[model samples]
Target: MLSATDIEVSLAGTPVLKGVSFHAQAGHVTAIVGPNGSGKTTLLRAMTGDLPYRGTVRLGEADIAAIPGWQLAAQRAVLPQASRIAFPFTVLEIVRLGMMASAEPPPERRASEALARVGLAGFEGRFYQELSGGEQQRAQLARVLTQVWDPVGPEGPRWLFLDEPVSSLDIAHQLDVMDLLGDYAARGGGVIAVMHDLNLTAMYADAVAMLAGGRTMAQGAPSVVLTDTTLSAAYGCDLRVNAAPDAPATYLLPHMARRAG
Candidate 1:
């Protein structure tokens, strides 16, 4: 499990996050839902120790600051939204880079397996930059999957920190990615995803933390956190929630408050 405590963040002389705290539990998905400036991404960066912030983060009860780089790399993996690469590399080569942190890691098998997991079995030799946006995102996911997936974990909790995992992905790919995340959690991994899509979050997340004004306004099960009241307050927009008759899931969409005409 991963826990963030009293986290405060500032970027370029401006405060972005204020004393944020939360936990990602094993066998569960904790989705961070918020508006554009909600500090969701900042909190994630802080949790992964990728950003400088004031707080204490613990991975499975061990102080994150105390853990060595190689050790932390093995225990947790972070998949940022996207990165700018100067040169294009083959997809296989890129995903295989994830294995650099492991000791005596399997090279081709790891890359191939991760690619296949992301539905990219034969995309090994394709140039990363040539792929479509969704495909490129999936490739990035393959790279992260190659790093984060630990099939056997009688050892320690595996944590995955993802920022907008489903952005720009088509509906099918979005569901596919969520399925993969659910599978990972079911197999004992923990996931914290910062997503802008609330409907998808309601469908896939076990718990949601709604951030507003750089703080968590609500954090609890989907049923409670995805309500119209919280949605309107956190997003500053009116929305409606409807439960499907066939499933236990709920869906959210804009209410489009009418102007006084």
Candidate 2:
């Protein structure tokens, strides 16, 4: 499991995250959702040890701070919000970067397989700079997957820290990526994602943590955290949550009419 306790982060002289805490268990997908400036990405950075903060973050039984860089890379992978490649690198070359964490002889096969998993099969020779935005995002995911192929390693459970993973993708690709992550969690790997789409969260996430004003407003099952009252309050808008008989997941709709005209 990935657990954070009393996480606090400040940028320059301004506070960004305040006393935020949550746990994302293995075999489940945990989503962090909030409005703009709500510090969702900041909180994720803290958990990934990318930012210095006052808190204790643990992966399984080991503190994240104490883990060696290489070992951590083998156990967890991060898919950032955006990746900028200054040079022209082929998809295969980019995916191979993740293999740096491993001491194995050759990772070409695994890299190719990772690309296929992300629906980018036969894209090994394609230049990353030439691919569209959504394609680039998938390539990045493929890179991360190549790094940590097994969700549960011999040491313990592995994790995927994704920052707005599907932001660049269209509806079909969004479902593909979410379903991929869901399968990873189902295989006993932990997944913690910062997401903006509430409907997707409700459908794919096993748990949701709502953030507002740098604090954790609510954390629980999607059904509990995605209530009309909680979401409306967190987003500062009147939201109507609907449940349909045919659909198992809840849908969130903004009642624009309720806004001051």
Candidate 3:
């Protein structure tokens, strides 16, 4: 499991995260959700060791800080919100960068398979600068997948830390990527994602952490955390949550204005 206890972070004397704690278990998709500027991305950055933080972050039994850089890379891969390649690099070349930490067999084959997994089979020869925003996101995901190809590595379980992974994708591709991550978790990998879409979170996330005012407001299963009251309080606006009898998912919508008296 990936666990953080009482994580606190500040940027240039400004507090961004305040005593936030959460666990993302192996074989589950854990999502961090909140309104803009609520520190969801900052929390993710802290967990990934991209930012200095106070408290403990553990990947399984070992403190993440103590783990060697190469070993840590082997165990976890992070897909940031955006990536830019200054020089023109082929898709295959970008994906190949992921294999730097591993000496796994057949490097070319692994990269190709990873591309195929992300629905970019024919993109190997394409230039990174030429792809669309959504395609670039997928290509980056493929790179991370190549990095941690096996969900359960010899060292233990692998992890994916994604920050707004689907923010650039269309609805169909968003679902596709979420389903792919769901499959990764089902196969024993751990996934921690900062998500924006509440409905998608309800459908794809096994656990949800709601953040506001730099603190975790709630954490639990979707049914428990994605409630009308909790969401409204966190977002500072009235909201509605609907659950259909025929479906296992919940839908969130803003409360419409009432007629004037």
Candidate 4:
């Protein structure tokens, strides 16, 4: 399990996250959701050690800060919101970079398998820079996937930390990526995603954390956290949530949202 307790993060002397606590079990998809500037990404950065923070982030029994960089790389992989390559590189070459952190890297076939997983099977020889934004996102995902190819390592379960992973993809690709994450979790890997789409969160996330004012407003099962009242209060907009009769999911109606008087 991964857990953060009393997390406080400040950027340039301005606090961004305050007293936020979170927990995610392995073999589950945990989502962090909030309105813009709500510190969703800030907290993720803190967890990933990209930002300094006052808190304890534990990966299982060991503090993440105590883990060595190389060992940590083998334990987890992160996919940023966007990636840019200055020099032109082929998709296969970019994906193969993921193997650099491994003490004993897997065979070259892993990269091809990852590309196939992300729906980019035959584009390995193409230049990464020429790919569309959505395609680029998928390629980056493939890289991250190749980094932690196995869900369970010799030490324990591996983890994937993704920031707005499907933000650049179309609707079909969004579902495809989310389903892929779910399958990863099903195979005993931990998945933590910073999500913007609440509908996708409802459909895919096993646990949800809603942030507001740099604090966690709610954390629990989606059905419990994604409520009309909690969402309206956090987003500061009048919004309605409805349950799908045919599916075990919830959806928010943007048309039902209205401005305050």
Q: What is the lDDT, from 0 to 100, of the residue 188 in candidate 3?
A: 95
- lDDT for 255 in candidate 4 is 42
Positional deviation of 164 in candidate 2, in angstroms? 0.4
lDDT of 4 by residue, 13-103 (tens): 8899989999999999999999999999999999999999998999999999999998999999999999999999999999999988788
Instruction: Give stretches of model 2 more than 4 Å off.
Output: 105-107, 259-261
| TM match of model 1 to true structure | 0.96
Which of candidates 1 and 2 is the stronger one according to lDDT? 2
TM-score of each predicted structure versus truth: 0.96, 0.97, 0.97, 0.97
Q: State how far residue 179 of model 1 sits from its true place (Å).
A: 0.3
- Residues 1-261, candidate 2, lDDT per residue (tens digit)? 788999999999799999999899999999999999999999999988889999899888889999998889889999999999999999999999987887564446999999999999999999999999999999999999988888888888888999999999999999999999999999999999999999999999999999999999999999999998999999998998999889999888888687655
Model 4 alpha-carbon drift over 4 Å, by segment: 255-261
**Colliding residue pairs in candidate 2:** none
True-vs-predicted CA distance for residue 199, candidate 3, Å: 0.6
RMSD of each: 1.5, 1.4, 1.5, 1.5
Q: What is candidate 4's CA lDDT for residue 83?
A: 93
Of 1 and 3, the candidate ahead on lDDT is 3
lDDT score, residue 90, model 4?
Answer: 99
Clashes of 1: 0
The clash tally of candidate 2 reads 0
